[model samples]
Target: MKNSQLYKGSLNTIILKLLEEKGRMYGYEITQKVKEITNGELAITEGALYPALHKLEAEGFLEAEVEKVDNRLRKYYKLTENGQLETANRLSELEEFIRNMQTLVHPKWSY
Candidate 1:
Protein backbone atom coordinates (compact mmCIF):
# COMPACT_ATOMS: atom_id res chain seq x y z
CA MET A 1 0.00 0.00 0.00
CA LYS A 2 2.99 2.25 0.41
CA ASN A 3 3.67 1.84 -3.26
CA SER A 4 3.46 5.30 -4.71
CA GLN A 5 2.91 4.23 -8.29
CA LEU A 6 -0.04 2.07 -7.33
CA TYR A 7 -1.75 4.72 -5.21
CA LYS A 8 -0.70 7.95 -6.91
CA GLY A 9 -3.61 8.11 -9.28
CA SER A 10 -6.09 7.69 -6.47
CA LEU A 11 -4.72 10.26 -4.05
CA ASN A 12 -7.11 13.02 -4.97
CA THR A 13 -10.10 10.76 -4.69
CA ILE A 14 -8.79 9.43 -1.41
CA ILE A 15 -8.35 12.92 -0.06
CA LEU A 16 -11.83 13.87 -1.15
CA LYS A 17 -13.37 10.88 0.53
CA LEU A 18 -11.42 11.50 3.69
CA LEU A 19 -12.51 15.11 3.81
CA GLU A 20 -16.09 14.07 3.26
CA GLU A 21 -15.83 11.67 6.14
CA LYS A 22 -13.70 13.70 8.54
CA GLY A 23 -14.91 17.23 7.74
CA ARG A 24 -11.52 18.96 7.64
CA MET A 25 -7.90 17.95 8.07
CA TYR A 26 -4.41 19.36 7.87
CA GLY A 27 -1.70 17.88 5.67
CA TYR A 28 0.14 16.13 8.48
CA GLU A 29 -3.09 14.95 10.00
CA ILE A 30 -4.15 13.53 6.66
CA THR A 31 -0.94 11.55 6.30
CA GLN A 32 -1.33 10.19 9.82
CA LYS A 33 -4.95 9.28 9.31
CA VAL A 34 -4.20 7.42 6.13
CA LYS A 35 -1.32 5.61 7.71
CA GLU A 36 -3.42 4.68 10.73
CA ILE A 37 -6.35 3.56 8.62
CA THR A 38 -4.18 1.39 6.49
CA ASN A 39 -2.39 0.11 9.57
CA GLY A 40 0.88 1.60 8.33
CA GLU A 41 0.61 -0.28 5.09
CA LEU A 42 0.13 2.97 3.24
CA ALA A 43 2.12 6.08 3.86
CA ILE A 44 1.43 9.37 2.10
CA THR A 45 4.50 11.39 1.50
CA GLU A 46 4.52 15.16 1.67
CA GLY A 47 5.90 15.26 -1.83
CA ALA A 48 2.72 13.82 -3.34
CA LEU A 49 0.30 15.25 -0.83
CA TYR A 50 0.98 18.97 -1.10
CA PRO A 51 0.71 19.04 -4.87
CA ALA A 52 -2.60 17.20 -4.76
CA LEU A 53 -3.89 19.64 -2.18
CA HIS A 54 -2.78 22.65 -4.19
CA LYS A 55 -4.33 21.18 -7.32
CA LEU A 56 -7.61 20.52 -5.54
CA GLU A 57 -7.63 24.04 -4.17
CA ALA A 58 -6.83 25.52 -7.55
CA GLU A 59 -9.59 23.52 -9.18
CA GLY A 60 -12.02 24.81 -6.56
CA PHE A 61 -12.94 21.33 -5.49
CA LEU A 62 -11.51 22.07 -2.06
CA GLU A 63 -11.15 25.07 0.20
CA ALA A 64 -8.37 25.71 2.67
CA GLU A 65 -8.42 27.63 5.92
CA VAL A 66 -5.46 28.52 8.03
CA GLU A 67 -5.55 28.35 11.78
CA LYS A 68 -2.93 28.94 14.41
CA VAL A 69 -2.20 25.74 16.22
CA ASP A 70 0.70 25.28 18.64
CA ASN A 71 1.73 28.85 17.84
CA ARG A 72 2.13 27.99 14.19
CA LEU A 73 -0.19 28.34 11.25
CA ARG A 74 -1.74 25.19 9.87
CA LYS A 75 -3.72 24.90 6.71
CA TYR A 76 -6.72 22.63 6.89
CA TYR A 77 -8.51 21.40 3.82
CA LYS A 78 -12.21 20.69 3.41
CA LEU A 79 -14.38 19.76 0.50
CA THR A 80 -16.42 22.49 -1.03
CA GLU A 81 -19.97 22.10 -2.37
CA ASN A 82 -18.57 21.07 -5.69
CA GLY A 83 -16.11 18.83 -3.94
CA GLN A 84 -18.94 16.95 -2.23
CA LEU A 85 -20.57 16.20 -5.53
CA GLU A 86 -17.21 15.42 -7.08
CA THR A 87 -16.36 13.09 -4.22
CA ALA A 88 -19.57 11.14 -4.78
CA ASN A 89 -18.87 10.94 -8.47
CA ARG A 90 -15.25 9.98 -7.93
CA LEU A 91 -16.23 7.32 -5.40
CA SER A 92 -18.65 5.80 -7.87
CA GLU A 93 -16.01 5.87 -10.57
CA LEU A 94 -13.46 4.23 -8.29
CA GLU A 95 -15.93 1.54 -7.29
CA GLU A 96 -16.48 0.74 -10.94
CA PHE A 97 -12.77 0.76 -11.59
CA ILE A 98 -12.22 -1.65 -8.71
CA ARG A 99 -14.87 -3.98 -10.05
CA ASN A 100 -13.30 -3.87 -13.47
CA MET A 101 -9.85 -4.60 -12.11
CA GLN A 102 -11.22 -7.45 -10.07
CA THR A 103 -12.91 -8.87 -13.12
CA LEU A 104 -9.70 -8.71 -15.10
CA VAL A 105 -7.54 -10.06 -12.32
CA HIS A 106 -9.94 -12.82 -11.37
CA PRO A 107 -11.83 -13.64 -14.50
CA LYS A 108 -13.28 -16.87 -13.13
CA TRP A 109 -14.88 -15.14 -10.21
CA SER A 110 -16.28 -12.43 -12.44
CA TYR A 111 -18.50 -14.86 -14.27
Candidate 2:
Protein backbone atom coordinates (compact mmCIF):
# COMPACT_ATOMS: atom_id res chain seq x y z
CA MET A 1 0.00 0.00 0.00
CA LYS A 2 1.08 3.57 -0.59
CA ASN A 3 -0.07 4.18 3.02
CA SER A 4 -0.63 7.88 2.47
CA GLN A 5 -3.79 8.01 4.52
CA LEU A 6 -2.21 6.12 7.40
CA TYR A 7 0.51 8.69 7.93
CA LYS A 8 -1.39 11.13 10.08
CA GLY A 9 -2.13 8.77 12.98
CA SER A 10 1.02 6.66 12.84
CA LEU A 11 3.79 9.04 11.88
CA ASN A 12 4.62 10.18 15.39
CA THR A 13 4.64 6.65 16.73
CA ILE A 14 6.80 5.54 13.84
CA ILE A 15 9.28 8.34 14.37
CA LEU A 16 9.50 7.70 18.09
CA LYS A 17 9.99 3.99 17.58
CA LEU A 18 12.76 4.62 15.06
CA LEU A 19 14.47 7.07 17.40
CA GLU A 20 14.02 4.63 20.24
CA GLU A 21 15.70 1.92 18.21
CA LYS A 22 18.34 4.02 16.48
CA GLY A 23 19.74 6.68 18.81
CA ARG A 24 19.87 9.75 16.58
CA MET A 25 18.82 10.31 12.97
CA TYR A 26 18.67 13.20 10.50
CA GLY A 27 15.74 14.09 8.26
CA TYR A 28 16.78 12.21 5.16
CA GLU A 29 17.99 9.29 7.24
CA ILE A 30 14.65 9.19 9.02
CA THR A 31 12.79 9.07 5.74
CA GLN A 32 15.07 6.37 4.39
CA LYS A 33 14.75 4.30 7.55
CA VAL A 34 10.97 4.42 7.40
CA LYS A 35 11.04 3.29 3.78
CA GLU A 36 13.51 0.54 4.54
CA ILE A 37 11.58 -0.71 7.53
CA THR A 38 8.29 -0.77 5.72
CA ASN A 39 9.78 -2.01 2.46
CA GLY A 40 8.59 1.14 0.71
CA GLU A 41 5.01 0.57 1.66
CA LEU A 42 5.20 3.85 3.55
CA ALA A 43 7.05 6.87 2.34
CA ILE A 44 7.56 10.05 4.36
CA THR A 45 8.27 12.99 2.14
CA GLU A 46 10.63 15.83 3.02
CA GLY A 47 7.72 18.23 3.13
CA ALA A 48 5.89 16.00 5.59
CA LEU A 49 8.88 14.91 7.65
CA TYR A 50 10.39 18.30 8.40
CA PRO A 51 7.16 19.81 9.60
CA ALA A 52 6.49 16.86 11.87
CA LEU A 53 10.02 17.04 13.23
CA HIS A 54 9.64 20.73 13.88
CA LYS A 55 6.30 20.20 15.55
CA LEU A 56 7.74 17.55 17.83
CA GLU A 57 10.66 19.78 18.70
CA ALA A 58 8.29 22.63 19.40
CA GLU A 59 6.23 20.39 21.66
CA GLY A 60 9.39 19.49 23.58
CA PHE A 61 9.00 15.86 22.55
CA LEU A 62 12.11 15.93 20.40
CA GLU A 63 15.46 17.72 20.55
CA ALA A 64 17.54 18.54 17.51
CA GLU A 65 21.29 18.90 17.45
CA VAL A 66 23.30 20.34 14.62
CA GLU A 67 26.53 18.74 13.56
CA LYS A 68 28.77 18.68 10.50
CA VAL A 69 28.42 15.44 8.61
CA ASP A 70 30.65 15.06 5.56
CA ASN A 71 30.28 18.52 4.00
CA ARG A 72 26.85 19.42 5.36
CA LEU A 73 25.48 20.58 8.66
CA ARG A 74 22.83 18.04 9.42
CA LYS A 75 20.27 18.31 12.18
CA TYR A 76 19.87 15.08 14.04
CA TYR A 77 16.83 14.48 16.21
CA LYS A 78 16.59 12.50 19.40
CA LEU A 79 14.05 12.05 22.11
CA THR A 80 14.06 13.97 25.37
CA GLU A 81 13.04 12.51 28.75
CA ASN A 82 9.51 13.67 28.05
CA GLY A 83 9.76 12.23 24.58
CA GLN A 84 10.78 8.82 25.84
CA LEU A 85 7.74 8.72 28.06
CA GLU A 86 5.60 10.05 25.27
CA THR A 87 6.90 7.38 22.92
CA ALA A 88 5.83 4.65 25.26
CA ASN A 89 2.46 6.28 25.67
CA ARG A 90 2.07 6.78 21.94
CA LEU A 91 3.01 3.19 21.19
CA SER A 92 0.46 1.98 23.69
CA GLU A 93 -2.15 4.21 22.16
CA LEU A 94 -1.27 2.88 18.72
CA GLU A 95 -1.56 -0.70 19.90
CA GLU A 96 -4.94 0.05 21.39
CA PHE A 97 -6.01 1.68 18.18
CA ILE A 98 -4.94 -1.32 16.17
CA ARG A 99 -6.83 -3.61 18.46
CA ASN A 100 -9.90 -1.42 18.23
CA MET A 101 -9.68 -1.34 14.46
CA GLN A 102 -9.25 -5.07 14.28
CA THR A 103 -12.31 -5.54 16.43
CA LEU A 104 -14.36 -3.27 14.27
CA VAL A 105 -13.11 -4.77 11.05
CA HIS A 106 -13.23 -8.39 12.10
CA PRO A 107 -15.94 -8.84 14.66
CA LYS A 108 -15.58 -12.61 14.82
CA TRP A 109 -11.86 -12.62 15.43
CA SER A 110 -10.74 -12.20 19.04
CA TYR A 111 -7.20 -11.81 20.23
How many clashes (backbone atoms < 3 Å, residues ≥3 apart in a chain or on different chains) does model 2 have? 0
Give the per-residue lDDT of model 2 (tens digit) for 1-111.
766686767888888899989988999999999889889988888888888899999999999999998998999999999999999999999989999989899899558
Scored against the true structure, residue 2 in model 2 reaches a CA lDDT of 66
For 1-111, candidate 1 gives per-residue lDDT tens digits of 476687988999999999999999999999999999999988999999999999999999999999999999999999999999999999999999999999899887534
RMSD of each: 1.8, 2.4
Q: Would you list the C-alpha lDDT of every candidate in the order shown?
A: 0.94, 0.89
The best candidate in terms of TM-score: 1
Looking at candidate 2, the ten consecutive residues that score lowest on lDDT are 1-10
Instruction: TM-score for candidate 1, please give it.
Output: 0.94
